[model samples]
Target: MDSEKPREIRIGNAERTTALEALGEHYTIGRLDNAEYSERVDAVTAARTRSELSELFIDLPEPTPFGPGDGSAALTPAARAASAPARIPDRREKVVRTLNLFAGGGTVLVFLLLLALGVPMAWLVFILLPMAYGAIRIWAGPGDVDASGIDSAEQQRRRDVESRRRKELGY
Candidate 1:
């Protein structure tokens, strides 16, 4: 207590406000009752030093700096840091998925419409969208292609087994 006395000297409004906030948080989480919360808040406002402010939180669990709730309690500190940025969806990814869906559906429709209209450049129009989509996929690299229950490796293995069986049956 004697050594802690020096650490509790003349604090400012900011320190008082911070301690008051901590007291409010303690009250909210049921750590401190209504009367205790009010008393601690008054003490915090009157507190003149760091140690004086520290006493309010002495029996309370440490407040999470990341957020208000216990949702992040299970996460590691690094995960908590990473999760803030991870929640935001990437704009580039959104554009890619939208483009893929539109281009795939648009290609066949455009080709058929052009052909039906008897356009001279129908054949050229027919290949353009598909070619553009292929180029985009190649440039962007593969994405979430496995929407079906089966993955590429499993499909390839089934195909190989079927081919071997057909060959053995002389088909």
Candidate 2:
């Protein structure tokens, strides 16, 4: 036996469970017989120290740790997207949004005003025209407004799928 002393730091339930799972894997692969597996499982359940847990894996390779080694990684993929400050819409997108608001609200205002003045209902189409454009602009999103919208990962994925489909169709 090696003379080096194992660390005896106290272990938690999660640590014990991890050790037991490792033992189960070894047994599943025939590294441990049924009797040996049962015995080790019992020992693992009773273990209280890191040294005890470490002893169970003395003959096995260490498993990889999950997540970042340091705790300071980006909070989300969106946050990691860019280090640049918040994106501001260009003049084109601003104009489009302004026009959109004006179209929708202006249509409603004019419609109410015309209705109050008792204008014929046939003239309502003039008010509805801008409102229809506003609805279309909203449905198409800012991408259509400025042609500068960033494609999301999901959008890229869908495009790739469509491209593959087109290739398969020989188009």
Candidate lDDT values, in order:
0.55, 0.54
Steric clash pairs (candidate 1):
8-49, 11-48
Candidate 2 per-residue lDDT over residues 1-171, each given as its tens digit:
666965457877666556655554444434455587667666676778765655655444322011232221423545433422235676656667777777767777777788888888936657577767767667656552212233355334444543453344333
lDDT tens readout by residue for model 1, 1-171: 477544435777665555555554444434555477557766666677665666555445446222334233455666544432223334445667777787866777887898898988877865787778768767776543343323367545545543453344333
Q: Candidate 2: list runs displaced more than 4 Å.
A: 1-7, 62-171
Q: Which 10-residue window in model 1 sums to the lowest lDDT?
A: 64-73
Per-prediction count of colliding residue pairs? 2, 0
lDDT of candidate 2 at residue 170, scale 0 to 100 = 37
Error (Å) of candidate 1 at residue 37 is 0.5
Q: How close is candidate 2 to the true structure, as a TM-score?
A: 0.32
Displacement of residue 47 (Cα, Å) in model 1 is: 0.8
